[model samples]
Target: MTIEPYQWAVRCPETEAKLAIRGLSKTFGTGAEAVHALVPLDLMVADGDFLCVVGPSGCGKTTLLNLVAGFETPSTGTVRLDGKDISGPGAERGVVFQQGALFNWMNVLENVAFGPRACGESKALAHRKALATLDMVGLKDFALKYPYQLSGGMQQRVGIARALTNDPQVLLMDEPFAALDQQTRETLLAEIRQLWQRTGKTILWITHSIEEALFLATHIVVMSPRPGRVRAAFRSRFNESKDPLITVAPDFVEAKRQIIHLLGQDANKEEV
Candidate 1:
């Protein structure tokens, strides 16, 4: 589809390649009773890129993610993965939700193996691969631990491991750290940074914090509240060093401030 000049969809070259979302819109109910949760949304996430999307509460940010995850469909527009229209969740797009989503009865190894087994992988091979993935996340020692036995951060790590075990090209996260305390959040942020650097999988993260978006993403897309629309986006060039601590640097703070100011601008316009 031909997105208009400078529209959110047309602006991202990444969307031109791997993943393209054009004039994406979603609504609930019908007629005057219907709520337009999102309107003509647009986004393009490139291969091997990290994109973070932030917006006020109830802005349909998760709705957009759900559409791509194939949990729901857009009322208008299209979401395409590699030029093919998205039908449903596939091995290519791995999702890590806010809730660990881990099977309580299963240990780390079992949880990671679930994806491969569902794909028809042999139990032996799947277990072996799962073990390797657990090691990759430095959770091999806790392979036998159930979700209940692990800390919130550890549980989230296992969630990440399970998604990675399938070797997905695109990793979509929905604020996986929202439940954790500050220190734990910071630690996982660093760990996730290293994981992204080592794995090189493109990530599209949904968050509400300007600081988190500026810290973790190479590109940050900020949306306005209710009937969410793309208010602004920024290319956060906070070095390619892969150090999470650099988020405290001057450049990082400035980028975050600018984005926050932009987000506030929309709130102001809406209030007026």
Candidate 2:
């Protein structure tokens, strides 16, 4: 299979973007002690786009996600969701962390229902929505179980179901499957892709696994090491394939190889 060239220019006009980042940068501390976590970067995620970010450690992938999620203020630049500036965390954006951040005291159903409940929905309505969302993640039967009772994979499913219950316009995930075993991670990857297809929600995912990004993202962004910047971006076709073994296809392998090469270069830069 012939490989298509990577698209280095992935930016789109703000008018057409579902999530837009412009000249975004973040710095911690001050003066000589200051740490530059992210450099000025611009990205545009269109509606229903699955955009995955990959890079070497300390490349500010999580920093960028936090900024977009409104968990932290940027040193400069702006993040706009649906043309409105994100002042802070809002219902329109739902975040999933690497570990399942469910409340241990709450059962799976209550944990998933908490978001809607916080938003002032009646308990009856919230429980109904939570049950429906749990069903979507194949965890309806586990509703009465507490986080401690479920396996790690099942807990993560609860995290995902919680995020979906609110019906957010954008989903922000920070290496959400990093803690899972390979088999479980792969299972969730396929499930999440199907979920995305079914919901048509825009997603911004950060993952260190190139295979995960290739298999799940419609667009991939590679960031350079520390003071992270967009080193390269590509529109991937592998995500469109339904075959489980597509990862081994020549073109898929080639695409992965190319990203590995880019990341290798970024590593070399960090060492120098």
Candidate 3:
């Protein structure tokens, strides 16, 4: 008798997982001065799903990411990954912050290899693996440059490569492209969409840009003001092959419009 490959499904070599957040609530301060950051929010991310979270500035989008990343504790409820409770940061989840986060002293190669090296990989093997990731993000030629010497976009590319090299099942990005120019942001968006297609990693992205959310996400999660809770969720699963430039496309435009609406008609009023 012949045995089958470990992953019967090509899409997932690992066992399918379901991340659950039950009766989650969080508050800051107390009594009259109390601020409710999140209020009984419940969300689930199945294996390989790409979810984008959008909300008003004080809506607790990052707060939610922090809870999931295990950087902070929820005042109530629980965050469980594959039925296990999350008490602290885990290698199962990798994160990329909003700003460019590359080491100024270390060159691009060293910065990208930091995680794997700290995980006990040999120096030669870590750098070797780092090189492969840098190549993936089109930064192979700039591997020797220090963080200060590279442009803002290049620095961000290195940060992303570092996160991707860890092979985390879930990738959490908090406004990762908010710092880049329009053109650079567009380029990186395409790069990320490609990476998602290739790596099949579950991604939870937080962003202020409606187009960006619709472009790279299979699901869009919108939140309301303080005590952030889900206001709306949209499905763009079959919209994968759609180009970002196709924003003018009817479906794309409609989705974009609806997301803007989900943000609340009053937000535009405040921006004005």
- Candidate 2 per-residue lDDT, tens place, 1-272, comes to 32354443345677889998999999999999999999999898899999999998899999999999999999999999989999899989999999999999999999999999999999999999999999999999989999999999999999999999999999999999999999999999999999999999999999999999999988889999888999988888787897779989888998899999989987786689
lDDT of 3 by residue, 56-90 (tens): 79999999999999999999999888878989997
Q: What is the TM-score of each candidate against the true structure?
A: 0.92, 0.97, 0.89
Top TM-score model: 2
Error of 2 at 240 (Å): 0.8
Q: Residue 229 in candidate 3 has what lDDT? A: 83
Best by lDDT: 2
Write one digit per residue (lDDT tens) for candidate 1, span 1-272: 01011333455564365788888999999999999989996688777778888988998889988888888888999988888898788988899999899999898899999999999999999999999999998899999989999999999999999999999978989999999999999888878877888888889899988877766777777888889888777666553655546767766666667777777888798889
Best-to-worst order by TM-score is: 2, 1, 3
Q: Residue 81 in candidate 3 has what lDDT?
A: 85
Show where candidate 3 strays beyond 4 Å: 1-17, 242-244, 265-272
Worst 10 residues of 2 by lDDT: 1-10
